[model samples]
Target: MRRPPQELWETDVLTFRKMRNLLPKYVFKSLENTIKQRTKLDVSLAPIIATAMKDWAISKGASFYAHIFYPLTNITAEKHDGFLSVESDGSAITEFTGKALVQGEPDASSFANGGIRSTFEARGYTAWDVTSPAYVLETDNGVTLYIPTVFISWTGEALDKKMPLLRSNAAMSKAATRLLKLLGHSEVATVNSSCGAEQEYFLVDEHLAQMRPDILQTGRTLFGRPAAKGQQFDDHYFGAIPERVQILTQDIEERMYRLGILLKTRHNEVAPGQFEIAPFHEEANVASDHQQMIMTILKSTAKKHGFMCLLHEKPFSGINGSGKHVNWSVSNATQGNLLDPGDNPHQNLQFLLFCGAVIRGVHKYGRLLRAVVATAGNDHRLGANEAPPAIISVYLGKQLEDVFNQIKQGEVTSSAPAGVMSWDVPTLPEFPKDPGDRNRTSPFAFTGNRFEFRAVGSNQSVSGPLVALNTILTDSLTWVADKLEADLAKGIELDTAVYAVLRQIMDLHGNVIFGGDGYSEEWQTIAVKERGLLNLTTTADALPILKEQDIQELFETTGVLTASELKSRFHAYAEQYIEVIKMEADLVISMAKTMISPAASRHLSEVSATIMNLKQIGIELEQENAERVASLTNQMMDTVKNLGNALNEHNFTTIEEHMQYCAKTLRPMMDQVRKYADDIEGEVAHDLWPLPKYQEMLFIK
Candidate 1:
């Protein structure tokens, strides 16, 4: 009996709404208190809370629970524990202890800890994050209680993305609170960062996905000639949703809503078979948890619908790659939205200062920001059509740019008010929403109330970028607070102090602000040569920035990440970069040899046979096609052998050197192999080709 989506709504989740109904008011309050105060679980109240959570889970048909954590890799990690316990008397009972609810042990060495945890010392802890609510995850076999958790080493170093994200948020909150207080806000609250990530992904036939080793292993096509009619015509953007996709979207939304995810919109993306789903803004930690789940659900639901979801940045060539536009801002209970420039000019002074702080942070840590999103998959998208260039810059729209320009020149005496767009006639409606045109090209753009960090790769976990953004902002805001305090102690007014701080920030870091097309090569050159900005175009260049002494000190001072933790993360990221590129290179070799070569060779054989037969008849059909096919097949084979030889050399003294070789030497070699392979694919016969064509994958399904 398939239930309609409306009837199935939240039926499988132990949401907060369900928790409210099951627990006593005070019991719920205790849980909230733990989240708000960062207090340890009250031992006496733990049983009560656990019982309520268990009851809610059982109501959703859950007989087991899983402590789900996001590890170094951008994927969900979980350890399922059954609720039933067999007694000595052979009786069975279901129970959940508060201690069990709060923590669990998982093997640390299994994750990408960058040698943080040795195989012998395989102990790791998963501490429950109550702020991100627990939920009931439904599977075909059974439902399980899913509690969001943070992974850490036995020695107390952060081993997972969530730990630093939470720590960074706390640091930012403290810094933002102090700054707000200095700005005359007495009733300050826990200012937390918020995010709204727009996830873009492609859907292809499951059969096709299963057949392609490249897509299966790399989440992208290693070799595919462009479709005859690609997105060049621009017909797919915001087009009507396919029926199958619509049903899948409905299923995913239902699952998300059940888990208390706040989904806002869905639409066809620019590339055919590509689409996007976005959630309304939520607290950064909770939003990251939901984002992981969103990706999970997208893949799981797509499987159910006979489609495979491709989150790879560039799943196919000759088309716009995917990106997760992470819209970020900070807010608190007292200050609804710290980034919001209120209508009143007097109140907006604080907003401008915070905005100025962001510019300063980005300018200072642009390389670090780029490092977080550096992946083999994303490198294809960063400077691609749908993505921002490698150079980091802030895009304040025309009106906001004008306001900031005035501030940089020493005084922001006035701000450009939102303009009302009139319809030229009395009977039409008017609006005031469009502040100015948006710059999609800018990697970091202030889109109204929030800054959209658009450079984040689609397949990445938002935790990394958020960790950097929050920590950097903390550094900048703390600097702003210190400067203002010094000026205030010298008897300066609040507005005067803020303006002075902003002026200094702009004068120093204002070069980061650009209101032009980021795609322009001229801007790229000017940004690096004239503006004194860091242009780290590759993971090899960017990841080293994480290990910089200043970056380590920044994290240590903010208490977001210790030096050891920073070192571990850098090693992990470097290893990941090396591993990812290696896998793709290996697959390119394998696919080119097994699939592409065979197909091209077979086509050549047929062409040679036809030409020879024509020569026998004394009717010379030109041998040009046969000659071309043979030449391409031979060239491709040689490149594959070259790539194979390159892959064999692994002796390296340092992680940095190894990563640089992969980035500089191995990557270009892989691209060279792909170039010939893709060219061979074009020349080869369609019927003889082993893998599905791009036209088939993109347009057919």
Candidate 2:
């Protein structure tokens, strides 16, 4: 029997449209205003709203409800409770109170708290985020109501990603609203940052993935020989999607649409067995939640289809890695897209102010931007020729760069025109062309209207980057607004003051903009020496920027994160980095000893037997093959021993020092072991190899 296809946007979601029908007019209006405007929820109406929500879920056959929250780690967590309650007569009755809907208590001791809370103090709360809608999630067992919430410690310190993101959005909106009001906009609605993340991942056969312990445990292969035919031919990019993968894509889209996620694009990515899925932009908080859902659904649905979705940045070495390019922008109901330069960009003061805010923010907080995206997985991808380099530079394109250069030169000039494209063949139609070409090498590039942050790892959550971007913009916009107000007090005209402020910004911070190829060594040298940009090449190098004085002040002033909260994040990330490397290092030793060495020994015995049989027949066989395999196998085991020793050394004085040791010492040793193991893999018999090869996992899929 075939399951009927689900209708788009009509499945399990309890959207605003559904609520409007379910609640009374006044109650629905108040809830809508609170959600859309980011205003405080009316506590008096909570019971009414809770009753409506409970009835809706009960009608959908939901017996339980769960509060879903995003913790410090890049994953989602949920605490479930049954809706069934006992009456005085021992009969059953369903009960969901306003207080229950508004708040939940979950233990915080086991999560990564960075010493924010003691083990004895195990209390944490999950508060309802009314901005994000609730939905009934259907499973094979039954259906349940999932409410999006924000998790925090008892003292109100943020213990999850959502709190920081919501706080950052609020700060950004306050700064943007103030700036807009100063620009003489009498009616300025609440401002908000938006995000659309392009997710890239690889799909491998489950059977093959199960054969490799590293992939099963670490989300990536710790050691593997490069495939004979890799993505060097560039034939797999944008190619036809496999039928099985296509079926999974459709299933994912249906699930996404039902959850009110606006998935827009799907296609083959740059590597074999890799693919990308993109969604239309949404408010930053909701977008972050939706992104998490997309990742979860990708993994779960792929498992159902007999595949394992690999979100690790470099799941397979020597091939293009995956990235989650976050397209970000700021806007409000009063102004559509602040970054969109109208047809005449020179005359658009509002657009210039907002765009200049982004430019100045990127320049002033480049280190913070880098810190937010740093991780163990990202370290393997950055500066690898597939993703953006570690240096944080903005690409404004030729036309926009020209405009900024003119501003820096203290002059007003005409905007650059976007031309038309024509060909000699009259049969084909002419098309309008963009004013400038795109630079994929740039970490933060303006794609016509919004900036695409290309350095975020595929496996990481988007909330960190979104939080950084919002907080930085909050600071920059505040600076701009202050400057504008000071100039206006000096009796300068609005247009003249705008240009003067932009010019000052260009002169002071315009060095961060680059239009050249970021992957080139020449640019790296120039960026460090001439441009004064910090080349933070690893997580250890970048994560320390979180402790900088200016960063701490920026978060504090913006009300995005307090000093303790910010410090906690730094410790959490540093510990996470150290943990990931240690796990991978241990796996490297185990695989080399328990898997690779045994395979090499088996193959060596087979080769030695062949040579003996030939010698017995009086036919001479060369000993080179046996010697090479034996040498590599021995070298691999020796390196594994060294790695184990390095892993044992924990003489670090601080978490930062420990992180650096892991990056500088343990990582290199693991690489050394992998080098020998991969070489042995190349020389050993294919049939005798214990782990599955890259070629079989990638191509066979």
Candidate 3:
């Protein structure tokens, strides 16, 4: 039966709602009540809720439950246990207790902790994070209880992502409240960090994705020729979403929305099969939890729709990569957005003060800000033409920058020029457009009311970057608040004191502000030599800065992260970088030796045979074809040997040594290997290639 296009889209949306509706109604209702209460979990209600959760899971045919937590690895961990026990009557029974609901113990020795945990001391605890609700994973046989929790070691050392994120939120809120109070907004309470993360990803057909060993193993195509019809035409950006992709997106969005995630936008991106989904802003902690859920659901939903979601920064070569653009801002229960510039921001003293605080934060801690987004996968994306450069800078637009300049020059009555808008009717009122234009190339850009951090990697847990952002902003805001309090106590007028601080901040750290192109070579030179900004280019270069005296003092004073916890995170990130590189190198060597090299050799043999037969029969074959095949075959052979040697020589004695090896030897060799393989792919016949080509995988329905 042929279905109408609109009906087809509606069907996809409906399918998603159905999947979400499969969950018990009471579960969602409980979440709603929980959100409304906005308090610590009631001890009395714990058991009742646990019983309800157990019963719901049992009804869904669940036999086991897992306390799922995000560890230092930045990925989720789960420890599953069946719900079976013997009753007094010698009958089988399933049971779950409040204690089990509240906490679980998992081994911690293997997890990275910067020497916090010894091999003999393997115990780790998972304490339920009541802020994030539980969900059920229905498998073919039975369901699994997925409890969101925070992991910690026996000695109370934080060993998970959630703890730091929660602490950072608290830090930001506390500091923000202090600043708000100074601005005479005493009614405002419970300041919160809000984030709207735009998740970008690529969708390839599951069958073709699985056929490529590199994609299957590395979450990207390690080597593939560029597709003839890439995103060069720019037709794919915000273009009509493909029907199959639309179905998958609809299904995912409905599921997410039902789970209380406010998904706001979905559209095609610049790369083929690359799409972005953005959610409405929410409290930073809730937003981070939802971001993780969105990624998991996107992957699962894509599978159902016969697609594979590639969240890697560079899923394909010669095309735009994916990124998680983290839009961040602060707000309060009463005052709304702290970052918002109302109709006339020039008169809005509070908004200008907070903006100055952000500018100071980004300038003072730009190195740490760069460190937040550093990752092995992201290393390939950053500084490329498609993404933000390595240098950290803020884009405040022309209006705001000029306003700050005017203030710094001691000018009074600084105001934006009134803009005009025409209405069709003569009696109708006219409106003005926004005062500033957007700079997509900027790493930290102030859009309407929030700063969009464009450098965050797609697969990263937004928690890490948001944590850094909130902590740094809190530190800067505290400084601003202290200065303002001292000035007011010294009998300086409030407006004069505010203006003094804003002017001082702008004059000192104003160099970080740039409204021009961030991707240009000229900007890079200006950012470093001209502005004297730190350009920490890689994870290795940036990770060590976390331990610097200034950063340590900032984290300690703000109480966002303890020194021990920060060190643990440093080790975790450094180790993760080396591990990712090793994995990629191993995959490259395996594919080159087992798949690409052999295929190239076979093609070479066939071409040589054809050439020999043509010569024997006195028939002149195309010399260009034979020469092309020979050149590619020789290049592939040399690259494979070099890649094998590089992989074999990698010293994995220590994490630091391994990371050094990867940076100096393994990565460069792998790139070389991929270069030759990609070249060969362009020359080799499609039938002779062992894996699916880029054109087929990118364009196939």
Candidate 4:
């Protein structure tokens, strides 16, 4: 049967409504109540829920179920279990109990735990996160029920990213709801932070991508020379989408929509063969899950179209890298967008207070914010002039900046108005968007009703950043609530109390707010030296901030993570950094010695023999080309030896020192090798080159 086009837009797979219709009325209502209240479903209710889930999966042709979890590695992990079971009579039967529906054991020691789990402590549990609906994933391997779960150690420690996010969300909700009541709003319930992540990525032909080892192993090209034509002309941004890419986009959207992802827009990006996808905002928890799904589906779907999707922050060296701009805001049913200025921003005391809370949060915990986005891939993008600077700063538009300045001085009399722009021709319609301009250079910018966290890497999970934002906002809102309570006790008017509380917040934290070019050196100096913001330029420098005393207290106070959990995260991230660099360094050395050298030597011999023939014929040519090739090859080989030597050194006093070596000593040595290798690439014949060139990989699709 032909389905209506609108039917394709509706969420069908594993959605709450689908289950609600599949199950008995009372049973589904009980399940809905449990999800809404964040409570455990009764054991009796679970059997009914489990049966309904199993029947739904069977209807979708799923013979197995997989428990999916997001671990510390910024990727999803799944363990599939078949439904077949043996009864006492030895007949085949499918059994799913409430207990089975709720829990499963996956090996924890195999995953990166930073010494948290030893070989003997291999037990880990995946408990159903009832809020994130389970969907039946379809693949050639066969249909399987995919359940979103929180991975945890048997001893009750959080062993995955989702746990912290859930905790942080709970903390933020409590604090926000308390503040709302203090401000005379009594009907507030379950306040949530929302996220709309703008995902940017590059699409390269799979055939070209496979030829590049770095692209295959590390999600980026490690040794490719610069493309002749980069994003220099500024023509690709918002340009027409390619036909092949458009097909891939439609396939991805179709799959994503069925899973309930609210995809909203698609377009070409600033760099050639690069594109972006954005979705309408949703609750942070669900939005992050959807973000991960989007990335997975993007790559898997592209492969079907013969394209390799590159999600690395900087896939190629000389062009604009990608970023996942996480648009964030907070609100509840009783309130609509706490950050919304609603025409007269200055007069909206509630908006000012909430916005002030964000300013304060960013200023006080900007280092934590920076730490969340730190990664080996992101190091090549952040503060590289095209992306936001490593230094964290908030960009409120000129009008909002002025309004805050007025509030700082004591009174806010008028707001910066968003005026209409009328075209000279009568046919064009008037536009009514706010006149406040957005600053792309700023790491965090307030756009309309939300803050876009532009510094987050393109390939990272949104959970870490969202957790930090929520926990910090919890702290800031707690501060506001305390001060407002004291002020109201003194018989001050609500508006007067809000202004005073916000004024104090602005006075203490307004240094983090800047509406200028964040990439400028002047801003860098002013930010670090004058304004007191930390510039953590590398993952090695930033990841350690996760264990800082202030950060420890921040997480502890909000119940987001314990001190031990934070330390474990620090160790895990450091371990990842070290492991990634070591692998890349090893790959670089192997490729240089084997692939690059052989290619270079072949070209050099061919050139030298041709020179000898020319000399015999009584004609002389410049031997500079031959000498340069030999010199570059020898220099690259020498650098490769140095990198190997550095990798062998294991005398680091601590993990931090080891990471510093990787970032400073090892990474630089690898780069030195790359410089010479890239030179050799230019000197060698393109037909003899073993790896794909950056231009071909970047522009061929």
lDDT tens readout by residue for model 1, 1-701: 54654666566566567667788899877766777766676667877888888987887789999999998889889999999999999999999999898889998877888877787898999988877888887788888888989998899988898999989999999899999888788988788899999999999999988989999998999888888899988899999999989989988888877777777899999999999999999999999988999999999999999999999999999999999999999998887888887764334877887888899999999888999999878888888788999899998887778777887787566666778888779998988866668998999998888999999999999999999999999999999989999999999998888878887988899899998989889998899899988777888888989889999999999999998888888888888999999899999988888888888888988888887898998988877776777787788788788888989987999999999999888888888888887887788788999998898889734
lDDT of each: 0.87, 0.92, 0.82, 0.89
Q: Name the candidate, 2 or 4, with the larger TM-score value.
A: 2
Number of colliding residue pairs in each model: 0, 0, 0, 0
The local lDDT score (0 to 100) that residue 544 gets in candidate 4 is: 92
Worst 10 residues of 4 by lDDT: 2-11
lDDT of 4 at 312: 93
List TM-scores for all candidates, in order: 0.97, 0.98, 0.91, 0.98
- As a whole number from 0 to 100, the lDDT of residue 324 in candidate 1 is 97
lDDT of 2 by residue, 1-701 (tens): 42444556746878889899999999999999998888899888989999999999999999999999999899999999999999999999999999999999989988998779998999999999999889888889999999999999999999999999999999999999999988999998888899999999999999999999999989999999999888888888888888988998988888888888878899988888999999999999989989999999999989999999999999998998999999999988888889998787878899899999999999999999999999999999999978999999999998889988888998877889999999999999999888879999999999888999999999989999999999999999999999999999999999999999999999889999999999999999999999899999999999999999999999999999999999999998898999999999999988888899999999999999999999999999999988999998888888888889889997888888899899899999998899998999898999999988998999744
lDDT of 4 by residue, 483-511 (tens): 99999999999999999988898889999
Off by over 4 Å in 2: 1-6
Ranking by lDDT: 2, 4, 1, 3
Alpha carbon lDDT at 538, candidate 2: 92
What TM-score would candidate 3 get against the native?
Answer: 0.91
Give residue 571's lDDT in candidate 3 (0 to 100).
80
Model 3 steric clash pairs:
none
Descending-TM-score candidate ranking: 2, 4, 1, 3
Best by the lDDT measure: 2
Better of 1 and 4 by TM-score: 4
